[model samples]
Structures are given as C-alpha cells and as structure tokens.
Target: MPDRIRVLHVDDDPAVVEAATSALEQEHCGITVETATNVADGIERLDSEAFDCVVAGYDLPEQTGVEFLDAVRKRSPDLPFILFTSEGNEAAASDAISAGVTDYLRVDGGAEPYARLAHTVVDAVERTVDDIKHVQNTRRERAIEELHSTARAFMRATTEDAVAQITVDTARAILNMPANGVHFADGDSLYPVAWTARVEELLGTPPAFEAGESLAWQAFETGEARVHDDITSIPGRYNPETDIRSEIILPLGDHGVLLIGSCETGAFDDTDVTLARTLSVHATAALNRLDRDRQLREEREFIDQALDTLDDLFYVIDTDGSLRRWNERIPEVTGYSDEEIDEMSVSEFFPGDEHETIGAAIAETQTSGRVTVEAEILTADGERVPYEFAGTRLTDADGTTAGTVGIGRDISQRRAYERQLERKNERLDEFTSIVSHDLRNPLAVAEGNLELARTECDSDALDKVSRAHERMRALIDDLLTFARAGETATDIESVTLADIVEDCWQTVEGPRATLVVEDDRQIRADTAKLRRLLSNLVRNSVEHGSADAQTPSGHTAEHDGESITVRVGIVEDADRHGFYVADDGPGIPEDDREQVFEEGYSTGENGTGFGLKIVQRLAEVHGWTITATESEAGGARFEVTGLEPA
Candidate 1:
C-alpha cells in the first residue's frame, strides 16, 4: 500500500549515516531514508521495521558489514543492500563484495562517496520495485486467463453440478487461495453445493447458515464482496482458533455465492473483487439455462403419459408414414403390438378398398392444418373393421407440417352384423322369384281347370275334370313345399341324411323302377327340408328318365336291369360328399344342364321344372352348394358340395 520506498542506512559512524541520508535524499527514486548508527542498532532496526534498500559500512567496531549483510540476507533475502566503506579498506571491501553485497563505495574526501552510495541505493531500489511489479503483472494476467477458461467451461456445462465445480476450480486458481467453493442459495440460506479437496481437508464441513447466519450469506444478500484478513485473529472468522489467516466471499448473483479462504493475511485485494463480479454473470446465465431444461423435460413426460392412456390406436408418424410414437391402446384396437406397428406402414393397416381414402385424408389434413376422419380399415387379423380415424398435422416452429398424429377405434362387430343383413336381403330376392315362377303357375292352372269344370258337359267331362283337378292339386302341393325350402333354418340339426333318402325312396310311386341307395358319411341338416329335397329329386328323375326314354345326346341307354335303373348313391368329389341321383337312361342335353336347376326350366314332356330348382334352393339354404353335371350312367348328376357337417 506504500507509495514511497523506505531506505535504511546502517554504518558505524553517525556522521557517515548523516552524510549518506543527505546525499541519497536528493535522488528522486521515491525513497524515504531511516538511519542506524551501528551493526547492532541496524540489526535491531531491521528486525523492528521494513525497508526497500539498506546502505551499510564494511569495517565496524563490533561487527563487519559482511556479517551484517549475511544477517540481512538471512532475514530478508530479496531486499537490496549496499556497502559504504573507507578508502583504505579495499581488502575488507573486496571480501564484503564477494559475500554478496549489493554495491560498494569508497569515501576518499568530501561528499563524493555518500553521493555515489545514494546513487547505488537508488538503482537497487528501482530494480527491486521493477521486479515486484513484474511478478504482480504476471499474476494478474494468469488470473485473467483462468477466468476465461472457467467461463468457457461454464458455457459447456449442461448441469448444475458441472457449473458449480467449474466455479470452485476457477476461484481457487485465480484467487491463489485455499479452501475455495461454491454455495447455492436455498430459500433464505446459502449452503455448500460444490467445493475443492482443500476445502474439505482444511475448512472441514461447511456450516449451515440462514439469511444472516454467516459472513458469506450476509455478503451475498448485500451484493458487496467481503474479506476476512485473519481468521485466527478476527472475531467473526469461521474458526478463530485455527491457523487460517484470511478469506474472500463474493456473491454469485441471485442464485449462489463463492467462498475463498487463504493462509496469508490480507491476501485478497480489488483484483479479486473485479474477477468475482465478472464470474457472477456467467454463473447466472448457466443457472437460467438449467431451469429451462428441467421444465422442458417435465413437459415431455406429461405428454407421453397422456397419450399412453388413451383408448385408441394413436400414432405419431413422419410424412412418409414411418412410425415415430405409439400409444398403449394401439395394440388393443388394431390387433398389432407396439413392436409390430413400428415396422408396419400406415397404408398396410388399411383395407385394400379403403387404403386410398385414408391416404387422401392424411394428405388433406397435412395441407390444410386441420383434422381429418376416415372409416374402414383392414385389421392385422385380415378382418374388415369399421374405423373412425382422425388425424391432425403437427407443425414445427417454422410452420411446416413435420408429421401427422392420428387415432382410430375398432368397429368390426358392427360391420359383421351389417354383412349378415345384406345376405338376408339376397335370400329374400330369391324367395320372391320362386313365388312368382313356381307358386303362381300352379295356382293359375287350378283356376283354369275349375273354370272348365263349370262349363263342361256329360260323363267324359267328369273324368277329364277329375284328371285336371288331380294334376292341379299335385302342382299346388309341390309349389308350397318348394317355397318353404328357401327360408333359413336357425336350428342346426345334426340329422342322419340317410334316413331322409330312405324315406323319399319308400314314398316314390315308380313301380317299374329299381331303387339302388348307397350311403357313407352322415350330414347335418333340417330333416324335413332334406326329405323334401330328396323327394323332389327322386320323383323328377323317375318321371324324366322313363323306361322308354331316349338320349338327348343321341347315345343309347345301357342298363343292367330289364327295367329303368334309378341309382341314388354317395360319392366323393374333391372335399365334398353328396348323394347323386344317377339313372341308366339318356343323359340330359349339354345345353340344358345349367338351365335345368333355374326356376321354370324343364326337360321332360309333362315335367314341372320346380323339382331341380327346389333342389338347388334347398342346397343353398342349408349352407350347401350344388352343381348339375352329366353322370357316369349317361343321366343327370346333381353334385351338391359344401355338405360338411357344422
């Protein structure tokens, strides 16, 4: 803190000290001189006070100046010392010079030696001051470099702990102090968050302090840097009994504080204060960034939880439909787990018929920045499930739609019920056709016959009328029975189809026909409908392929019997087994094979075509499928497939 340098003159003669002071005082090297008359007094003065330079005489009454130089060197090795000697004592002077004295001057006459001694002291003092200034400049530059390094680290740090550590390391290195650390402000208190190894070893555990408990907290609250010059001597020092000498506590803005303790007394000055103030700005910025990062992480977690609990097939997809995010309920609704859905394309999840509609809806939503809705999707199980799909375009901060978010729920059961309803309507159309063609024809014939009977004459009229009436009654009965065959039977009866076939055979009135029946597999069907179907087929075959019948194909009929052979037998064709009515008469014409089963189409002279039509209708109504083809016996073959028991 001293602006003027202090020079001490030590000589055996008082007149010499006086002459030296007068000579050195005029030199403006910024020195204030203090005189000591002898080696003993000089030793006392050197122990008692401080000075920048010393001027001593070589030969003394009690001790030599060389010995005094040794004492000075022992006490203050860095202080500059000069020797002023008698002109005749060159031997002692040379010895003194060899012993490492700063400069030597011989007084021959007048005041020349004193003036030269003053000159020597001034030069040594100037050199010592320059050396001190150079050391201080070096220290200041190092502190600045450390601060810059710490600021870079602070900028690079991503967490509070990392920032706190950087602060502590920088404080210790820049301040050249021991027990350096950072303290965080929690409510009204400042607590140690991070500290160096010296802090733990020398300072021990940090003390807990509220708003005004410690000097550090007080300094932080007041926004003023505080210094403790000597902890061992100061009343408010952390450990007044220990060897700790000084400390500097600085505020790190509104969030925290830094504490720097030193072993040297009065160590920190204005330079440390400037450094702390600069570092606080960087610390505040780091803390602000940390707070924002924490908030963003919390927000993301909340959004994820909300999406996961939603009961729909929710997804976040890139513009190309690569999956980005998936919710928990996607698996439940779409029959695809998260692992499976991630690999699937958005179009892959839609029905073959509805894929384009969904893709268009997504494109529209992306372009318009609005939600879109689409129905119908093909599920992972290959079912056409009705879906209510909605999407929204997710935009980035630059207002470009980066992706699409969508939700969908399953409606498969509802779609299945609607399909079942459509099938029922188709059956109703079949029923209407049957009534118009089969039922109306028979009723018209009956009405015509009755009109004829009312107007006819004599005995021939009664017989002809009886014949016409009987024919009308048979046709009417057959029409009613065939009409009932089209109705769906809900009761799935597992009846033996062989019993119905045998019953139909027993009822047939073909006396000249030989009935050959063969059975193997059992069938599940309505017994009444099966009986009606078998009776119609057997009766039609008997009437159509008479014993004297000729082939439409112009091929002769071959039979093993003298009579017309009617063969009803079970045969295997692909995956289906059915009883085929085969006769050893002429086969049906190739042109009439398909038309024979169509309503109101016939091949016989007096045949009502309802027989073959009823067979096809009943087969379909029972969930069975039938086809008409030529039999091996050169007669008609009705092969009814889909006859497997449910």
Candidate 2:
C-alpha cells in the first residue's frame, strides 16, 4: 500500500555501499536507501524496523553471505534477499541459489548492477504482497458463500415449527451436530413443538417441564442461553436422560427454548454457545413479526379511529372547500381550535390567490374521489410551511359529493432526506466508476505480470504476487457489492442451497478445497446476489482455514494451511431456524472474533479487509442477519437467520 520503497544495503566497503545506495535512490521515483556496515547491524535493523529488501555482500567480516541469509531467514522468510558480491563464478552462484537468495548480482564496474538489484527488490516486494492477499481473499470467499446458503434456508421458514426444523437440519449439515429440540412455552411450562434425536425423549409429553424447573424452563424464565457440559454432575431435578451428557438451552424470548443435546460429555464449546445465542435472537425476531402481523389482522376493525393518534393534519371539506371536520392534531400545529377550524373555509389556510388552487383541488377530489397536492399552508402565526395534502371525497348513496376527508403532512424533513439521498447517489456513482476503471485495470495488469513472473522463476515469490493481486481484486469487487447491498432487491425468489452453492463455488478459485452439501433448503433471495454472497464466504473459508498452508518464499517460515474442507447445511433449535457453514481448519480466535466483519481490519498481509464487510452488506440487502463462531473441526462457523418460507 505504501508508494515509497525502502531497501537496506549492507557491505564491508563503505565506498561501494555509498555509491550503490545513492545511485539506486537517484534513479527510482519512489525509492529510499539505508545502509549498514556489517551483517549484525543489518539484522538489528530488521529486528527493530521494516524494509522491502536486504542487499548484502557475499563476503562479510564475521561470516559468509549464506550464513547471513540463513540468520535473516529465521526472522523474516518472505522478505526479498539479494546477494550483491564480487564472486562471479558458477560455484558462488550455485551456493547463492542453494542458500535460497531471492536474487544474485555480481559486483560490476558501473551502476548497472545496483540498478538491476533495485528493480529486483521492487518486484520481490510486490510479489510478497500478492501472496498475502491471495490467502485472505480465498478465505473470505468461502465464509460469504456459506452465509448465503444459510440465508436461503432461513428465508424459507414460515411457521415456528419450520424454523426449528431448519435449525436442526443446519446443525446436522453445517455444525455436524445432529441432536436438538425446539420447544414452545405454555403458561407455566414448556412443550416440544419440534425436535430431533438429540433431545427427543426428555420432552415427549404435552409439556416438557414446569416453569423454572428444567434447563429449557430456566432458559425461558431468564431469557438467556444455558450450557450444561455434564448433565449428570448438575444437582437438580432435570430432564433425567441418562444418555444425554451435555445440553444447550437457548431462550427464544417469550416464544420458547431451543435445546441441543449430545450423548457425549463436553461435546460443545464456546462456538456452540455463541451460535445458540445468535440463533435464539433470530428466532425471537421471527416470532415477534408473526405475532405483530396476527395482532394487526385481529385489530383491523378499529383502524378508522386510529387516524386520531397520527401526527399528520386530518380534515373534512365540502365540495366548496369549506372546513367541515378536523382532528386535534390540526389544531395543535396551526394554533386553531376545532371550533375555529370548523368555522373557517379550507381555502383560508392558504394565503392570497392560493385559495383558488385549494378550491380546484377540492373540486377535483369531488370528481375523482381522491387527490393529492404539495403546497404551502399558512399557520395562525402567518408562517408558510411546505405540506403535502391528500384528500378523498365522501359521496352519498346517490353519488353526490357530500364532503372530502384529507390528511396533511409537513414535507420539510422529507425534502431534506430526498436531497441527502440524491447527494449520496452521486458520490456512489463517482466511486463505482473509479473502482470499475482505475483499480481494476491496474489489477489486471498486475495479474498478467504475476503469471509472467511464475513462468520465469519457480519460487514462493509467485504466491506473494498472486495474493497481492487477489487483495486488490477483492477490494474492487467489494465497492460494487457495497452499493448493491444498500439498494432494494427487486428480483427475489426461492433459492436452493444445493443449487446456489454449486454455482457460487464454481465462480471462485479454490485450491485444495472440497465443498460438502448437507441439506438443501429453499429460501427467498435475489439469485445473483446470493451467488455473490456465497462465493465470498466460501473464499474466506478456503483461504483463512488454510492459514498455515503458505510458505514464505526465501525464509524458513512455515504455514499449515494449504487445503480445507467446508460444509454447508441447515440449523434448527426449539422455535428458531437458520443455516451454517463450517470448516475443518484453524478456527478464528475468540479475541479477534467480534471485529472480523469490521471495515478495513485484517490479520492477513495481503488482505483488503473488505471481504466480510461485503458479506454483511449483501445480508442486509436480503433483510437477513449473520453471525460468526467456531466450526466443529476447530474452524470458523457462520450462521444466517431471519428467514421466511419460500
């Protein structure tokens, strides 16, 4: 990311070091040179600071150049190491090659050697950056893909039981845990509505437990998640299932409890705990929406009188534009009582010739049954404020206009919002063009160079170049996705996990990776966006899960992540439904877990840090929610919820 290049030149001859350092910096646009007299000082500089490349002489006072290379390799392996020495023979070249030097340059009479070394240093640093980026992008893509698949399953759940079923399936497919129970709460007890073999026998009756009695009851009463590692060790009158050694009870607010149990003790960990909490929260929201819709249906008879509680101005006018009736809200805003408004013509609220416009609006309402206008209205204080008035004409049985009912709202805030949105759209348009053109073009060029570099040399430097290229590409991609996520989704339909996952995985580059499909649930989503989302998630898993797979090109650095296995499936708990993606690799650490989705935060050297941000944005586009935790194989697990049945 830094435009300036910094290289450390170390040698025993002061004159040669000064000449080369000065010549390299003078010739390059953004190169700065620093020097050390011996290898010890160079090693100290590396320890205390950072440099793009290390240029050292083949012969040093204390040791050979190979020894220095070996020592520096221990500290930083991926850093470019170049040998600038007097030895020009094949034996020396072979020794440098065996020592894993990034580049070799023999001392020549002129400035050509230094100039060539400078270019090599730049290319080597660029390659390292690419390698880091490649890994980051790969993992992000996988994580996003899993999130999308889970989202599809969540949206298809309509009923409470369906929600729980999806959650169970998600557990089996993604979490690789098959035992769970979805429960509903009665007045003083909990009843099993949906469940799997994990906790079936414990709650088979109409009511599973009395209020505040069992783990499920306790979760409901406290409105919190409960984890019992060893059920036999707990001294209480509980489910008393001998086969079940561990259980997790997550509260679904007032709805019920989601219970996932295991026959083996200590089968669950922190990731499961966090997952339970997240799914429970989602279940609560789904239940709330359903309850609200049900209540609205039952209370429709009193909707007419509810207008009085609204803040807008409400009034009735005759065909002549005379004010006949108005609500208390009108008086509060206009500084007029009901009696005064009743005595005044609706035209009186408009100053001067505007009354004619009101009269025409009233007449139009009488003819068409409804009319709306944005016009200025004068309050009692004589202040003209912008207002939007919508009116409907009341007609008799004979079809004669008797009066007009109208509502007026102040447009001041609406106007401000409109302007703000307009400006935001303009900025977004400008940004989209820049991302589509500026960064993308250069990225393509870099990618081409990376391929060239790979064919020219067989070293880990190519990995760095590839990673840096991916990081830039991911950033450009995130810009487009971010804008789309905030917009309304017009093309929505049921998307199947089995279908979407295959399509998404095909679009991303997965190295030494396998995708396992556990359940195929249908949920509502924009097909294209869902594919994009899943692609990013899967990429994330593939790259991050294999954190140890990378080998820093020149140094002795070792990474264990080269291949990974990702699982996608549906998850259910008592009264809640969702889906998940799990991997078999090094899981995310607990300390860095909360900030994973944050903008521009990354642990990977080449990461653009926008990958998860894109994932979260796409989720908002579909009105879904997501969370991250550890997977069953000590890898990351991401769950998505807030779904409705397709």
- Tell me the TM-score of each prediction against the true structure: 0.51, 0.41
lDDT (CA) per prediction:
0.74, 0.76
Summarize candidate 1's per-residue lDDT along 1-646 as a digit string, tens digits.
Answer: 2468788877767777777777777765566888876788988988777788888777766888888898898877768888776733767777777777777777664557767776777778778778777776787788778777777788789988788887877766676655788888889988888888887787687666677657777778888877777666555444456555777777777777878877667666666666766676677778778887889999978887888877667788898888888887766666987788888888887777777787788888888866657576666787666777778889899988899887776666767776886787687667756666676676678777666766774566666766765666566555766667767756667766566777888888777777776664477777777787778877766766665553434344454455666777675767676667777656677886787778767644455657888888888888877776787877777677676632
Give the Å error, residue 96, model 2: 99
For model 1, the local distance difference test gives: 0.74
Best by lDDT: 2
On the 0 to 100 scale, the lDDT of residue 379 in model 2 is: 89
Clashes of each: 1, 59
Tens-digit lDDT string for candidate 2 (127-192): 877875675455445534554576556655667777667666665555556777677888998877
